[model samples]
Target: MDPSDEGSSGKRSDGQIPVPAPVMEKKKKMMKTKMVRFTQAQINNCIAYKEEEMPDYDSMPSIIEILSDDLANCPQDYIDELKTIDDSREEDKTFWIKMQNEIRDEREWILRQCFTKGYAEYEVDIDDDDDEDNKVPARVAAPPGRRRFRNGVAVKKNLSLSGGGSVRKI
Candidate 1:
């Protein structure tokens, strides 16, 4: 029997070695959690359909821009639909509350999916093995050229590619 094996008398009892503590442990949940409250900045970021906000989905800036522009030139029927939605909000407080809740969900989703800072700055990552063929080139400094943001999709850039030699750029 090894002398060090004993706690005091150098006699082993269980014949098992002691296990060390883990390097990393799971984090504990926060007790005093702050709830997310809606603000004007957040409301401004909302992606609304027509004048009313689009609840429960991503409200992309492009989507909002398209809706606004379309409303400006949209037919009376389309405008009526928008007004109906607004009227529903005015008539039913519960409906408005539901919409507001949906918008909150959308806001959270947007913050999760898109940039937390509101705007995303896309930049290519450079690796050690970068070369002429495999090089991570910088984005084009020139303007995107004639590609206006229409209805959240690129209007100038053709996305359809169906032919012998298919070519589509967005």
Candidate 2:
């Protein structure tokens, strides 16, 4: 009888340590996305439509610039508003949020004449490996999702992609 095998209760008897078998991990749920490669003609058509029919927005004013101008002209605009209601009351926690909502409202108004009404399903990424300047991007960035006060507590809200907001909703 092998001395290594003596007094064994189905345990390893070879005097060598047994390494545990690797555990099969549960398959993780990955984001489901289908890549649709547009033909050169399709790409050209899109570019052509924007170039031909769409009014040029190259010199269009941005919200950042607009707001900056507004605040710059009157640095105490926010403070002034706060003062009129209650400046002495601790602090206005929802002031910034109210400003954010105003911005959202303005964005929605500006985008009322959008090409598409709702969100887009497909997100395109340019796979070009070139490290050059002025490279073209296919499609990207859904930035919507704002903090809205619900019972004075901030809650998430969704905005449409047409309003330059996110595709996901809350």
lDDT of each: 0.53, 0.47
Candidate 2: Cα lDDT at 43: 39
RMSD (CA, Å), each prediction: 24.0, 27.8
**How close to the true structure is residue 36 of candidate 1, measured as C-alpha lDDT?**
48
Model 1: which ten-residue window has the lowest total lDDT? 56-65
lDDT per residue, candidate 2, 1-170, as tens digits?
45454444445646655545668998443444465544556434443542123333444454445566565666576746644544323233355456656755644543442335322233445433332445678787656885353454433345755554333334
**TM value for model 2:** 0.16
Q: Pick the candidate with the highest TM-score.
A: 1
Q: TM-score for each prediction?
A: 0.18, 0.16
Q: After superposition, how far is residue 23 of candidate 2 from its true place, in Å?
A: 2.2
Colliding pairs, model 2: 144-165, 144-166
